[model samples]
Target chain A: MSNITNQSLSEILESIKSKKISSLELTQAYIKNIENAKKLNAFVTTTFDQALENAKKFDNKPNNEQLLSGVPLAVKDLFCTENVKTMAGSNILNNFVPSYESTVTKNLWNNGAFLLGKLNCDEFAMGSSNETSFFGNVINPIGDHLVPGGSSGGSSSALAADLTPATIGTDTGGSIRQPASFTGTVGLKPTYGLCSRWGIVAFASSLDQAGPMTKTVNDCSIMLEAMSGFDEKDSTSINKKKETYSKNLKDNIKGLKIGIPKEYRVDNMPKEIDELWEKGKKILKDLGAQLIDISLPHTKYALPTYYIVAPAEASSNLARYDGVRYGYRSQKGKDLIEMYENTRSEGFGDEVKRRILIGTYVLSSGYYDAYYLKAQKVRQLIKKDFDDSFTKVDAILTPSTPSSAFKIGEKTNDPVSMYLNDIFTVPVNLAGLPALSLPAGLDKQGYPLGLQLIGKALDEQKILNIGYAFEKNCGYKNEIKKWWS
Target chain B: MSLDKEKIKHVAKLARISVDEAKVDSLTKDLNSIFKFIEQLNELNTDKVEPLTSILNQSLRSRKDEISDGKIREKILKNSPKKNEEFFVVPKVIE
Candidate 1:
């Protein structure tokens, strides 16, 4: 059953279809695993009875043909799940339950995917580590002491710990990829507008994208097929035809051109990561793909530009949480102003408050031109860098994160250090490109390292195909940490 | 680009959040440091550079100005802290 740790969605569904495993029994098994793995803190809430009831309904249906029928999956807390407490890892939303479901979650339910429960995340999906969550930090199931990357930390950790077969996570700036890298799992951030943002608790309107996190790239393809579609509710949702993402998994990659970004080979990168990247390039080369040198010279500006743009939009999006509206409101306030102040002050965590402050300052009247406008211009250059590079190569490659997972509390105090963690992954978000982080190898400390593949806008299929090719060639499956097993 | 204590307090107020006086000092220092780092952007010659808003330069699609169907008033008001029979209640704003 431990080999069930990384089963693809199709395999799991086949077992259920043949009556080899009952949906109730499968959900029960996952529930049992989650119960025993409580130390990992992978789940914020688990709806066992609800999930079982839903599974029983599916069991009775004789003619259901949904692709993800009876598959149990966890949702990141950022998406609004109707009637469930969808707190985006903050005290402010502690009591908030949406009356309507987020489009992504609703689509998943429509496809017959069982909703296990919501997972933990950083407050408003702001931090790179799970430590900022109001529900308490999630521990990496692979190792007890290492931090699970965030704001999708719980989703990644839950999948890694085998609490769920697959999970859905949203990425804006490296939320999905960074944590996926840390947990040695497959995480995909699809092109912007590929998934609707109507009910997603907005972090940054322009950058937020919902994607899948699973144990294998094949599972990611299956989950992505179910999660993505056009929605009239979201103005930015692209009206593109849908296709099976895993249809071309067996496609050949011979004569494929993979771009290796020169700028990502910065002087400050750790030596082990550099060597692993070289090894990854060689593996691709030996697998009949050609490596082409590319340049994204504006790479150094990605972190600064992202910080300014994301926070500015976050400040605006979070303004909806004033005391009068839905969410936690202060009980002992004398007046409306005091109520507003007290509610937000007590509800939001430190990191959220810090971002809100920075956001407000940058978008303020006098500083808007100096900071926000400048960052916007730099954003154009960053996108241009990718545009120019894509003209030369099919996809761009770089180390997902500069280093492996850092110890908890290592860079929490220094905000700059924390922001640097997303340096390589942010540019892709800026350009609205599709990127996937696949485990390449392990660092000296035995911590997992990830190599990122970035494709052009709306080219998610290509990135997944490339990731599939790499997975086949590498055949690299390290043993899950003893604790997870 | 140095943010003083007063500027930090003002920014916090503008953001509608409260900050402790002691914490304000550290926030000022941190904001100043970040701003100084961002000052590197000033070195690039961007006189003719246009600010990019969206990744694709395509224009936003416009729908006809017609009333459609969406009025979840009850659902929207369900989570409000203070609400009346048909509307959300709040403290008086005007004297």
Candidate 2:
């Protein structure tokens, strides 16, 4: 049963084209899977009728050349969908439906991708585990009680559970990649501005980037092609000419130089993870790629610096959700100030409030120079570490997470422990580099371990090519099928 | 790096968030512990390092200052708490 679940997106598309199955039937199958796997809590909202109608439209359309035509995909609930409730996993947005669609969702639909549903997530994309979501936590597909990481936990779980062929997820500080690692799927966080952020419920505006979550690297490449482009409406959108991302998948990796960062292999890393890194190195070396030892010495400082910078930006971006304009308003308020305070206090989850407060403190006049400005300087040094390493290596490889998925509620009580889960993935975001997580091997507990590939900005194709080649060689895809059954 | 109850209250107010009196003591303890941990960054030698506001070193490209579709009245109003025919409604502040 898991065998069929592990089929690549390209194979599914071919099966649809040969009339072996219709898009409507495929959508129905996934929707049925979602219903059967309800205990996983992978989805926050399911659009059964809209998905069926869209699949029917795909059948009637004369053109079928689009790469993702008829593919059933789940969108993280953070993205706004027209007439559908986009909750961002918070009660404040429980009943709020945007009349306009997010640019990413609109692009997917325009490219013939069908929406399966909106997946669950951390409230406003704030937590490392799925536990903070207003909707109940999403469980890992492989183990019923284990966590699917967040804030894109639902997207990762859906892909892992065979509920969808692919999904769109937003990554601000490992929201996408960390969860993908937890669930043993492929997740990409393209260079910031590669994908338009217009209509995405803002979390940390400067750091947020959206990408695809799928069972294979090639599937992610195809989905990324459909999702990325320049947009006039988004101020941060890059103005580069559009190009096909999947075109470089078959490129040779024989001479590729992969860098192993000494700093990442720190004293605190578990022995199993260290062994996994060694295994990854051996595999790459066997493929005729050169391995070079490099140093990102500033790595330890990245986590602390990101906490300051991301929260500072988030504090400002989340300010728009006041009671008067939109979203939740407290009923007990007697005046405007009371209403504003009461609404946010009641509407936001504890983590969101914590971040807003931390952000406000760092950005305050007295401490701005000491905390926020200092963190920014460290951010530059962090980017330089990667920049200096890239000069010596064609690409960099690291474990996607410090360890595999932990059980739900294991670290929820301690925010610091939860933040450490993204320690390896955050620096890639801070540098605005393209990175992805590919299933490497299984840990002792049978949960999947993911190996990450980091590339120079706009060199996403290089990393995808390397990952696709690794997938072909490693063949972890077969093991995934067993979990589905 | 120790966050006192007074500091937590002041920060919450600056962020426009209201914390009940009972919660302030707990928040202070939590913030203090977190800040104490993060204060390890102070030990790093970053004297000459330049601050990076954005990873992209290039200047942002400016778009033409022409309005295309500046209005989405109906769509924007869909999430509004209180709205008249043409504008959102808020409490009057004028005396």
Candidate 3:
């Protein structure tokens, strides 16, 4: 079990298929790892009993053709797991257990994956750090006090610590990528409509996309292949045949033109991150992939534009939590209006409340055109910046974040400073393109640094291929002392 | 302050969240700084660009208006904090 916990998802699947290890054995190993790694606060709920039961059932009758038979995986709490507490790291939905399963999780289970548990995340997926969660902040497995990133912080932490073989995380604005970058794991935010969002708690409807967070590039590709497809329930879901992403991971990146956006060269970027970016470029160049200078001119405006668009949509989407249908309700309120207000004020965290207020203000009558619409127009320009650049290159390369994982309380107090964490990752979300973040090197502090590969919309296979080539060169792996144990 | 007290109060009301009077001062400051930060976007010339609501550039895929989903009334009601046999119980609204 000790040796098995260190194996990749692909290795686990192969081992299970060959009967070298039973699904129940693997499940128990992960459950033990999760039990031991509790200090990281990676999971909001651990469905160990249910996972073991499912694993036993699968072991009793092995399924040869199933993609990930009996593989234990965790999902970010934002994805609604049937009969499981889907808190989304908010007290409002702390007791809310969905009777339905999110489309992404359902797909994973359908492909013979067993659920380890629901992972912790930012409250309503709002903040850049896991500190905003109603549950306490998730500690990075790399360092004791450092954050594991957010809102998919728990997903990344668990994957990095080997608590789960693979996990699912949703990226609204760099949530998945940044955390993966910080934790030295692989995370992909697939194209906006590539995966269905049904049953996943809405953060920003237009920006939310679910993808796989895994221990390796091949595992990420395979998990994405299982989790993606069209569902009529999600109107935005694209109607396309499911792709075998793992089969398409051709390590030949030769003749591929990778674009390096000049806007990513910020004035105050840490030297280590810059050096890692350079190392990433050199790796690609050595592999025969041409690096070209490109400009995403509207990149500077992405953060502000995201702030407006995301919160505006969030305010509308969250309007349902009014002490009426589901979630927490105020007990002291005497009347309907008071009940609504009291329930929300008490249920929402500070960051959630702040964003909702901003959203409400911007979408309010006189300010709608000035703030919301203005931001949308700028969002178009940001999208155009990428659209134009894609014609010259096959994919874009950049650092995943400005820095590696920071201490828990470092940026929590400063909202503006915290928003800058998503500086490199947000523009990709704005343009609705697929991006993968994989470990390129370690920072001076010994925490992992990640480099990103941004692909043209629906070009996930291309980026994964390039990522596979780079991943081979770096030989980067998540190695941590048994601190939490 | 970028947004005055009345404006903050109005926004809070619009958002349906009651703000504590004590927190409003801090909330105002936070919103002000955020608004000021976002004001940087005003410098960008977006006069010719159309508002991009959806990034996919794909039009809404509408289907026949039919009852494709149902039979989950019990499941829907199960999540409500307070619910009767079929309906959720909320505070009285009628006079």
Candidate 4:
């Protein structure tokens, strides 16, 4: 049953329902692969023993009624799981285990999926490259030295490597979509409030959302249905009818209008990426979807705007970590104020601290109006750009990144350059819109390049349908060699 | 540059993260570069535009005044770095 570990989430569910494979057999295969793929550094914490126990329990009383149907999944460590250590790739929470489960993970468990382990991510989901993770960078399985696109890097790397069938990741300014693009997988960031934020370690509260990552678009649909819903506990969660995404996957898109945003064509973009965008447009056209050239005039300002808004919110959210209650407390403080200072200084990584300072500065007394409030006003204009464009197009199509995966340390020193990775994906988040990134094709060096479908807010179903049609006709099949094991 | 070592230090102090004296120079450089990039926002005039605190248009969600949850003190304190009985012990505040 080693091949079971290589199957899609939908395939695994079908196999289990047919009684062809037991949950134990499936979980064991994944556990064995995870043990051998230690070089990937994808997992921050392994729950193999607990996973086996749950699998055995499921095998004894298999229920085919659940959505996941006894599948095992590893998710980003940002989700707080009861009785398990949920570190947000920071030293501060290394010893802090949650006493409750996150709404998203709880939804997964209630759907019959058990935890496989916790995957690595950037510290508090801050960096574009997974390099900022305190657990260390998750190496892209595509190449030996490349950084898997990050914040949700471990989830992408592990999913692409077939270590887990389908996983979940949080997207705050492209954390989910960017990594999925680089890793040759499917990732979606639902509209701002599609999933609950409760029990997930807070990043930018307004922008942070958890969504599904998978090898195939259909599997992404299945996972999304199980993971999202309106929860009273999360005030931001949408209060609406539950979506049957997996049940509604359709390929016929005869008259769908897809906006091709002109501003996404940035200066000095790689030739291969331009060609990839062209190829994607042609594919969409051949699938009978009409393409319109549109402009999101505020595109260039989105990144700068995000840097201000995200960090401002992040600084406020992260102020909870002062070593008084949970997480790391420094041993070197003289008094109360010094203790708060010392704990934060030693506990957080450099990138985390950098953002905190930026946050603090922008929202500080004299700078608040010039920076934070100004960025927010500009953010409204950015959203208005999307709202106007949506009146003309059903969804917008763009490249997922300026380029494919880079070396781990290539842009770490220059924070601005690293931030440029999210240029194409950030605008969708700013508008509180749903977007999906699917592997469109491979780059010249064989790294996967992705095409994004940005839908109007609360229109995840539309993008998923569009993604399904494109994936079927694009003829892009990702082939990965078992190099890590 | 609006951000010098002094500005970074001041902000770090406000955020309660002690800046290592050695990192102030590099931190100033990084922060100044970010602020420089952020200056691009001024290129667009956003007069009369309301700062978007959230994309959702709904008013602040309110719930009825009623007890929804409580009595999980042990669970809450389970994560405290230093706890004694019913309270999380912090550094001497009165001293």
Q: Which pairs of residues have clashing backbones in candidate 3?
A: none
For all the predictions, what are the DockQ values?
Answer: 0.64, 0.68, 0.85, 0.86
- Put down candidate 4 lDDT per residue, A195-310, tens digits, no spaces: 99999999999899999999888999999999999988999888989999999999988899999999999899999889989998998899899999999999999999999999
TM-score of each: 0.97, 0.97, 0.99, 0.99
In terms of docking quality, model 1 is medium
C-alpha RMSD (angstroms) for model 4 = 0.9
* Candidate 4 clashes between residue pairs 3 or more apart in a chain or in different chains: none
Model 4 error, position A387 (Å): 0.4
Report the Cα lDDT for residue B95, model 1: 69
TM-score computed on alpha carbons, candidate 2? 0.97
Q: List the residue pairs that clash in candidate 1.
A: none
lDDT of 3: 0.92
lDDT of 2: 0.86
CAPRI class assigned to model 4: high
Chain A TM-score across all models, in listed order: 0.97, 0.97, 0.99, 0.99
**A1-485 per-residue lDDT for model 2 (tens digits):** 23343577888887778767778878888877888888888798999988999888888872468878887788899999988999999978887988889999899888878777999999999988888899989988878778999999999888888888889899999998999888889999999999999999998887899999988888899999998998877888888987787876774689899999988876678788888889888888888899999999989988998888888998998888788777888876767777788888888888898889989998998899888888988889989998998899989999999989998889977888889898999999889999989888888988888999999988999899888888877767524432433
What tens-digit string does per-residue lDDT give for candidate 2 at B7-58? Answer: 8888887777889888787777767766776677798877898888677756
Give all candidate RMSDs, comma-separated: 1.6, 1.9, 1.0, 0.9
> lDDT at A295 for candidate 4?
91
Q: What DockQ does candidate 4 have relative to the true complex?
A: 0.86
Where is model 3 chain A poorest over a 10-residue stretch in terms of lDDT? A473-482
Q: Please give, for residues A1-485, the per-residue lDDT of candidate 1 as tens digits.
A: 44453566678877888887778778888888888888888788778889989888878883348868887788999999888889999999988988979999888888888789889999999999999999999988667888899889999888887888888999999999999999888899999999989899999999999999987888888889889999988888888799788765654778889999888987788999899899889888887889999888888888888888998999999998887868888785667777777788888988898888889999998899988999999989989888988888888778999989888888888888888899899999988888999988888888888999999888888889888888887776756754743
